[model samples]
Target chain A: MTNIKKLISKPLFLPIFCMILVMAVNIIFDAINGNFALNFFTISVRNGILYGRLIDVLNRGSEIAILAIGMTLVVSCSAGTDISVGSVMSLAASFCCMLLAGFGVSSTSSYNVPLFVGVIAGILLAGVCGAFNGALVAFLNVQPMVATLILFSAARAIGLLLCNNLIVYVRVDSFGVFGGHLGILPTPIIIAAVCILVATVLLKKTALGLYVQSVGINRKASRIAGVRSERIIFICYIICGLCAGIAGIIASSRITSADSNNIGLNFELDAILAVALGGNSLGGGKFRLAGSIIGAYTIQAITTTLYALGVSTEQAPVYKAIIVIIIVAIQAPPVKAFFARRQAKKAALKGGVA
Target chain B: MKSLKKINGNTLLLLITIALFVVMYIAGCVVYSTKGFTHLQTFLNILINNAGLLCVTCGMTCVMLTGGIDISVGSLIAMDCMFIAVGIEKWNMNPILLMVLVLVIGAVFGMVQGFCVGYLKIQPFIVTMAGMFFGRGMTAVICTEQVSVSSSELFVKIAQTKIELPFGAYTNNKGVLQVPYVRIPVVIALVVLIIVFLMLKYTKFGRSLYAVGGSEQSAVMMGLDVAKTKLKAYVLSSVLCSIGGICFCLNTMSGSVQQATGLEMDAISSAVIGGTLLTGGVGNVIGSFFGVLINGTISTLVKTNGKLLSSWSNIAVAALLCFFIILQSVFAKIKEKSK
Candidate 1:
């Protein structure tokens, strides 16, 4: 009983509960339609690959899951959200496609540059963009939103200029591998898993996570304790940029083209929402990777559920807003405090009666 | 000398913005001397083009002054436009009545968001983001197809009505007179700007907004109602944004889900460039007006060049935003050192 109590009291408990709660809605939805209650949980093999609603959620959620790892760190270190990740994703995808299909050439069946070279260049450019934002925020002390606002508007435009105001399509089969399948498993799922694993290991194996939390909690105190707080913040943003680049590649590779205008539109919002849904405070400090990953998948689950229920794409945001409000209100401090106070009152009354 | 010493950080940033606008305008005139950039009509055209942006930026300035943000403004504008367009076209409602309904909706929307942020202590970004989603989704629900207000007699008349300037009249190559003029929206926007300027300068509620933004704890200690102030600020912002939406609808004469998309960023950037701090507490409506003008002029310059792509204007605005932010930071550092 004590062990169960401790598990229930864990910091990660709320996010896991929320995730399960969201997925449970699908179960209810299925049962109401006279389908099996476990319909949402069923997984089957098709064409030597796993396929199911659950699998779809995992597969579709790869980009946000990958972006969440970096977002968690950035929020922890800087106590501010990066609003440029969506634009950076679009920019990186544009650069990769532009290189693959040479400048002034909108469509190509052959590569102008090696696939790996283009991918690396895209990620590196994203890193450079990150560095610029970091310099402004970490050294020059500009607000994170204000500093990143520069890229949020400019990156997509630069992407447009690079693509010569056209969507660059690389119809090459090899370019599709990242967004396609490898040995019956979607490559995007594998990529997201690897990124999450690497981030988890890096955070667990080093003192970097501690330093980031310390800086987030109290920058002056951390600096006094010999931590390079500014450097830590800069590194976080660079990692975030790199993550966006990888996600961008996967995104573009799925379509086998870079549509700069629409790719990753409003994705930064999703990434931030993932972090919030993970039960991490937006004000910064301690965090958990598992929770954020779950949050990302939960978001995808919500979308998949809505689609299965026949909601049109245009109307999905309204339902999404309603769900988000309910969830956020539940986690609100006042609501929590109210519940806690009620519980205390109940306990006191029971003791008096006994 | 005594008055010079009183030039604090807020006033200093405002002065810097004014000077930058002046320099950029002069440079534009010199570079495009043959293109009539120096003509008074060109300046009026900037104001005419960005009237909706001007009103929206004023609302953004108010929210920023209270240390909050409203990204839903863009989405709300879309909703307002769709409501007006559909109400008049499909529902066959009165234009003036439809506008009043939009303002009421804006108030209720703002009230809900303000209650969440102020009373529940939720993050403004998250609340407003949800609001953004809700507004946009509702717009799509209202009408998935674009509805142009072509058949509405009153709307068309209001849109076509132009107030011509007495000066800046010139003769064209065809021996016809070309008199510079602005539409009714420009007049409305300017009136709003003046009203906001005065309110921010003299009203008690406005002073409380600055106090709460400067520091919440201090504001509470000063016996000011921080939550109420925040709530009122949001209400003011949304009301202004709805008014701006009317202006935007007048300009476009159509309603679509994509209408005024990404406009929130424009308003926020304008407020920031106009010397409003994101951290809150220092801003001027007059400065924000010039910020809108600066953005307008950049696009105008790109248009007049005729050779450059329109995307260049976006890049130019981003660069200008970067410059102004850096300048503000340096000025802040200097002030800290002096203190």
Candidate 2:
């Protein structure tokens, strides 16, 4: 009972709660509108609205979820946030498109040798961009915001320049299959799950993860304890870059075209929002992969619910912004402390009665 | 001499930026002369046209110095443009009244952000980010589409009137000239710079901004009203942003929500290129002016080339932003080593 209570009070619990709450509210709304039915221990809903949309949520959630996992590591290293992940993703996508196109494969090729090659090349390019960002923040001692902001603008421009500001389409069956699903499980969702699993194990079972948490808690103390803070930051960025590259592939594959300008636009914002909403402190310490996954799903579910309720696409950002504000407000220390104190008083009264 | 030495590093950075500007301009001149499309009048016009960005960048530098940022400035400019268009075109208000309205609106927007950030202890980035969304959304809500001002006699006169000065002439058609009235905003920006420079150097509040930015805990311990100081800084930045916005609207005689979409980035890049540290506590308004000039010159150079995409401006600005940030990092390291 104590272990269960402790688990419920954990920071990771909030994102899951948020997701479940949103899902419940959505189902209640659906039921009122006669879209859901419950018949003797069985439940049914409109297939398009619930199950089909869940697939969409999973597909879209994958990129941000993966990026947030890597971002968790970067933030845990006390290197601050990277706002250039979106730009890096775009650069990778553009590079892949350019490579595939250079190989003379039309937009409708069934088998293309260059497709896998392009993915590898794109990942490498993204890694290099990440290294550049990490170098500035770790070695040059520039603020993470400014260093990444430079790369954010420059990388996107470089991508657009490389692609001549054109959207390039590539048709590769293997690439499409990577983004497609098997038995109602989207490939991106599977990829995200695998990435989360890896992150969870690495963070929970590895010395490097502990070192990163120490650095985040107190850089001076961590350094005194012989942790290589700079190297940790560098490695974290490399991982972030790799995740961003994978996200680019999924995003581009979904559209069947790589748009230099629009591909991965505002992705960094989404990833950061996911990380923040997942109860990962912007001030950084312990990492939370499950929380981030739940957070991403929550965001997607909210949008899906709003859209189903006939909300305009333009209005979605406004609602999402409000939700973000509320989540952050609740997560604020003062608010949490108020609730904690209330719970403590209630527990004391119950003990006295007993 | 001690102050000079302290200011010397920033000055050297400014000089290097100016040198780069000159080199780029010379290269543009060569390209234009070779293409037989160089025009002295056109070059002067470009400088005058870019004065509004110069004003906006000036405000950005001040805000950045205080360890804060305002991405909402671009959207504020959009709002200003809408209001100005509505005031002049719809209500037929006096042009000066429009300007005053813009300033007041900008100040209010800034104050709200300042209150959230300074008093509520909210993060500057999150507050400003919220402000950006709200301001842009408000602009769109106010004006469904572009609003063009047609019959503002005062604004049109200000924009159309040109005071030509004799200079270098490549041809009779391109007689050497300068437009004084068109560059009025630049002059206004210069006056603001002078006043701000004095305040930064002499006033307690100005000193407190540096202290707070350098170390908020230390500033609080030193009995400085860090909250008030920060609030005042942000409010001041917003007012300057408003002025720049109005000037921009006045220059174009039109207002659109999409106008100044990336203007915040332009202002930030200019501030960074001018030697403002991203971590705050150190910057110069004058250097920021040259930073804007460099950006302006790049666009002009691209325009002169005729073959290159105008987006080369963004590329050039990005390059400069990266270069100067690297430079700032090196300087910071030197300072740290000295300490």
Candidate 3:
């Protein structure tokens, strides 16, 4: 019982539980439809690729998952959400496609340059944008949201200009490999995994995680303790930009085009939501990277569940809002305190009776 | 020079914004003289086109003064427009009643968000973001198609009612006298602007907002109710936003799910560019009004150019936003140094 209680008290437990609860909805849904209750868990291989609703969730969730990795670090270090990730993603994709398709050539069947050159250039550009935001926030003392808001509005417009106000398409088969399947697994899933693994290793294997957390908790104190708080924050923003770049590349590759208007639209909000849902405080402090990864997948699961239940695309957001409210309300400080008080009262009463 | 040194950070910021607007307007006049940008009518047309934005910006200034933000305004405006359109064209309900209903909905929406943010201590961004999602979803639920107020005579009359200016009449290329006129929405927006300005300047509630935003801990020590102040600020913002939605409806005379998609960003940017600090405690409706004009002028300038892509306006606004932010920071540093 003590071990169980300890497990329940773990910080990651809540996010994991929330994810399971979201998936459990599928069980009831399947039962009601007279199918096997475990139908959602069933995964079958189709022509050397994974096929299932869960697989769909994983496949579709890659961009957000990768974004959440960077978002987790930024939130932990700076205590501010980067609202420009979506636009930066769109911008990166546009730049990559523009480079690959050779400027104003809207559509092309071959690479204008080597594929890796365009990809690296796209990610580097996003990093540069992130550096600008980091400079504003860390050095100039601008609020993160305010600093990022500049890119939030300007990035897409800049992307449109880069693409000559057209959707640039690279039709090469090699171009789709990033978004396509790799050895019976979707390439996006692998990319997201690689990003998460690299981020995890970087944080855990070095003192970077401790530095980020200490800075987040108290910047002045950390500065006094010999931590370059500003540099850490700047590095986190660069990482976030790189992550958004990768996600942007995958997104454009999936569609085989750089759609300036639609690529990664509203994704910044989703990435933020993923971080929030992962049981991390937006105020910045200690963070659980695992919780954030789970949270990202859970969001995709919710969308998938809504679709499988036959909810229309237009109506999905309403249900999503309701679900988000319930989850956040459960995690709210007042509600937790209330529950703790009630539990303490009951325990005291039971002791007195005994 | 001594008096200038004594002018304070807030006023200095506002003066910078005013100067920037004047300079930009003058530059526009010089560059686009052939396009009649010098006409007084051109200026009034900016007001006419951005009346909804002006109202929304005023509301944004209120919430921003309290160090809170309400990004749900755009989605709420879209929902309001859809509601108004459906009420008049489909349900045949009286337009006035529908307008009242939208205000009530706005109040309720704001209250819920405020309760969550103030009482429950949820982050304001999260609560408002959820509100944004809910508003947009409700809009789609209400109607998936474009619904216009074409058949409703009362609505059309209200939308088309022109308040012609006694002056600013110009002789056109056709050799006829042309009078510049604004629709009813512009008058409503100006009234709202003045009312908000007065309320922010004179009312106890307004003073409390500044106190809370300036420092929550200090406000608590001062025996002010921070939560209630935040709640009221949000409620006022939403109520005013709904009014802006009505003006928006009057301007468009149509409702679609995608209506006013990014208006919240526009309002926030305007408030910021107008020298309203995002961290709160310093802003006014007049500054915000000029911010709207500056944005409107940029779009107009781009349009007059005709060769430039429409996206250039967004880039210009962003550059201006960055400039103001950096300027505000520099002023902050100077104030700190002097202290």
Using alpha carbons, what is the TM-score of model 1? Answer: 0.96
List of clashing residue pairs for candidate 3: none
Ranked by TM-score from best down, the candidates are 3, 1, 2
TM-score of chain B of each: 0.95, 0.89, 0.97
Q: Please list the C-alpha lDDT of all candidates, in the order they appear.
A: 0.89, 0.76, 0.89
Give stretches of model 3 more than 4 Å off: A1-5, A351-354
Question: For residue B100, what is the lDDT in candidate 2?
Answer: 94
Error (Å) of candidate 2 at residue A354 is 16
lDDT of 3 at B303: 91
lDDT of 2 by residue, B52-74 (tens): 77778777777787788777788
Q: What TM-score against the true fold does each predicted structure earn?
A: 0.96, 0.87, 0.97
Docking quality tier of candidate 1?
Answer: medium
DockQ for every prediction shown:
0.66, 0.38, 0.69
- Model 2 docking grade: acceptable
Candidate 1 per-residue lDDT, tens place, B30-112, comes to 99988989888899889877898999999889889988999899999999999999999999999999999999999999999
Native-referenced Cα lDDT, model 3:
0.89
